[model samples]
Target: MDLSRQRCRLWKELVLVASLLALGICQASGQIDINPDSLIGVETYRTRLVLENVTSDSQQNGPMFTGRESVLKTGDLHIRGSQLNDTGNYTVRVDAINGTQRATGWLKIQELEIPGISVNATSVVEDIDSVAAICYTNDTNVMWYVNSAPVSSNNRMTISPDTKTLIIQRIERFDSPLQCSIEIIPEIFGRSELIQLTVAYGPYGMTLTSMPNHLSGVVSAEIGTPVEMKCTAYSRPESQYRWFHNGSLLSFSGENISLPSLTWDQMGSYRCVVGNSVTQLTFYQRLQVQVPWRPKPAQKRVFTVSGSYVVVLIVVTVLGGVVFCATLIYILFKHYSTRTNRLI
Candidate 1:
């Protein structure tokens, strides 16, 4: 009798275990899921409530998420399109008759495809307003970036109504890298590669700042000394420098013109022409290079004075010559006379 009762209890226990197994049908899994914006589940809960991931509480709208894109179908979370700012951790929870089942996963968005990125003008003159830029693609919209920073619409830069084209008005001559990208879920969508811009401006701040007197706007070099002068300018797309003397071009290319030693023949009107090939704008700065060193005559003097001192030097020189000749003649005559008397 005891053995039959024990078998009966064992059979009841087996039945209870099977019932619990059926109730545990819904289980949570941590999987990396990719979606446009929302993630789905494995089992369908007709009346499902999102415990997380929505901007607003799902309870306020309805007992379940019935939004066309958010409907829980076949237990999958149907997330929808997203803005650039939408990103981060997202999850969903639903109550099953047996217990609560939730899928915990993160969201990631893929960037749109584009044929290419290009500007309306590859090279533009600086200070021009409203130059159109386009990101060539089937996509109706694209976000523009300058040097990796998002380009916002303003007076100088305006986005078109469709957002595919960007207009840059009042373009400065500063060269910058431009890119067109899309906004994704977690971060900025991958941008279309291959877009760079060049802005051409005049040779800016062109001046010869190396010569000793260059600060005074004059280029002066000392004769018989090494000469190095620089004609420098700040510009975009780099300015090509040309050095000229007496209206003739030098055979060198660079900001600096150097000579091992300067001479009087090298003294002339030295000019530096700074030109920007992109803009075809040129600027010129001219100054006379004067060598103040002069050759002195063989005459020696303790002090080199000018004006009335010249007369004093002349008088002293003549008096010294007269005294010297007289002294020599008297000495020669006395010697000759003394010798004649001795011979007689």
Candidate 2:
């Protein structure tokens, strides 16, 4: 009788345990809830769902929820779906089985609006200051971006107060192609077609040369006497050539420059420098002037020898004549005297 009583107590305890397990299973399976029936202006909407335990007071463990490899939790579960063109309801189901119990939720989708913005100026003079206008299709608040950086009026940039346009006051740098983009915010989705700006700071090069190859002689020479120098130069920007004589500016006329009549002072190393606002180039040459030298006769020697030498020569000649005459006469007298003595 005692053994039968013990067996009956054991059976009652097993039945109670089985009933408690069944109740726990029902409590573990819960319901889910999501707010906002529909969503708008979003490419994809994330819907959060809350799961509440209806029967149980303690938490239960099971396999975590998933959607196409995306993890979903019990409470505050996020669901996402594709709505490329169609905007309508998207159903998200959460399958949980704890002794046969399951739950699901739903969300709605909508479309958003974007704005438009573009650049006006395409090409501009290089180095000098220029302006590019950023305009919006519907005259909305816009921002300016030059090569991907936001610019406000500083040393080299100026943005208009309205924010619809940007005026680049000075382009002190960058010689290559520059890109300007405009972004308009708010209701409209805006993007600018790239306005390629070509900054051209004109080509600059200069060449200097002498009209007639520079050498130590008369260049722009006269027929007989004075020597002159001519210098010429060529350049894209029409270079101005200044003739330098021993490092001093030599004045000239027209593009064909001419130095003053060459003198001993002007004869030295000469060079022609060609330059403009853009570039400077120089050509060098050596110059020398030649003049003949003739000596003058002595006036003092001509006057002193004129009378004295002539008188002295005449006197000597006259004296010799007189001496010869006297000699002849003496001879004749001697002969006559001798004859007289003989006759006596």
Candidate 3:
């Protein structure tokens, strides 16, 4: 009886060991995870496993691939230094106790180079000069931008067949700081240096304003009063200004002018001529200036009453003088008569 019990215990221990070994062999053939893409000179790990006698079509006993063990007892295929020629499909196989399992993947290695841009001219005249710009890159994926916004073919602009060159028949001043970029993927990209464009524009929309505004195209002010005028126009390189009076050019040339004291000689039709040298464009504005004639000084005034009071005073003076003369004559006549009668 003792011998039989010992035999049964030995058999049970052997079966338990075999079952544990089978479970370990099944766990060793776990799923594989790999990086599909990598950059040149970068280290890449293709897979992680603990399977027995692992092999891959990408690895042919070369020094480029080295094997390492992870903390979880997982085997890893390590690429020491990736190269441009090492881009292709890869297949890995593992020999397990159950059967031969396989996992396949693709690896793409790329070499990135700096991008550049070239242009025919940096400065151009608006509506007269055309511009061409080209991007330099080995990549076929190209994109263009103007002022940080994407650009496309339009009536005034066109793109080349390969989308590497951009042409503008009539470049405007508002379009500047062009840029080009290569998009390898959503996460990988390269950009070129910004190229600025200088466009010379016009001298249009001319306006002349006075400090004391004019009424009905006429500037009226009193003699000896100061007047000021300012002229302005829209331009790229700053417009040149000239002043004219009565169809004759003045000695002064600027955007603003002041007449210290307005006079007859300084009054007439005033004009402001604005011109651009680069674009060879011109504009002008006109206004009439009039100085009113000054009036003369008045004579001194005397204190006097109304016409009716003057008439009353003259009549009263005449009556008083007549009464006094009549009284004196009467008294003299009476004296003469008394003397004569006494003598008789």
**Which candidate should be chosen as best, given TM-score against the real structure?**
3
- Residue 197 error, candidate 2, Å: 0.9
The list of candidate 1 runs beyond 4 A from truth reads 1-116, 135-142, 173-175, 184-190, 211-215, 219-222, 251-253, 293-344
TM-score of 2: 0.35
Model 3 alpha-carbon miss at residue 43, Å: 13
List the global CA lDDT of all models.
0.59, 0.45, 0.67
Estimate TM-scores for all models. Answer: 0.49, 0.35, 0.56
**How would you encode candidate 2's per-residue C-alpha lDDT over 1-344 as one tens digit per residue?**
12112111111111111222544332344443334433342334443444455332222322422231132333333346524342333333332344433343333333322333444455554455476666554445555566655556677666677766666755433522333333322342344544555543333343333544434343443334344455445443555556666777766634444444545665455665555444333444445333433478866544456788899989999999999999999999999999999999
Cα error, candidate 3, residue 73 (Å) = 22
Candidate 2 C-alpha error for residue 220, in Å = 30
List the lowest-lDDT window of 10 residues for candidate 1.
Answer: 6-15
On residues 234-292, what C-alpha lDDT tens digit does candidate 1 reach at each position?
A: 87789998889999998888988776788888877878899988777899887777766
Residue by residue across 1-344, what tens digits does model 3's lDDT show? 12112111111111111221344432333454333422222123222222233322111233322333111223334343444444544444444455545554454555445579989999999888988989998777778888888899999889898989999888888678888888754555567899999899988778889967987767888779999999999898999999999999999899998999888788889999999999999888888888644688999999998999999988889998999899999999999999999999
* After superposition, candidate 2 runs with Cα above 4 Å error: 1-84, 98-120, 172-190, 202-344
Better of 1 and 3 by TM-score: 3
Query: Whole-model lDDT, candidate 3?
Result: 0.67
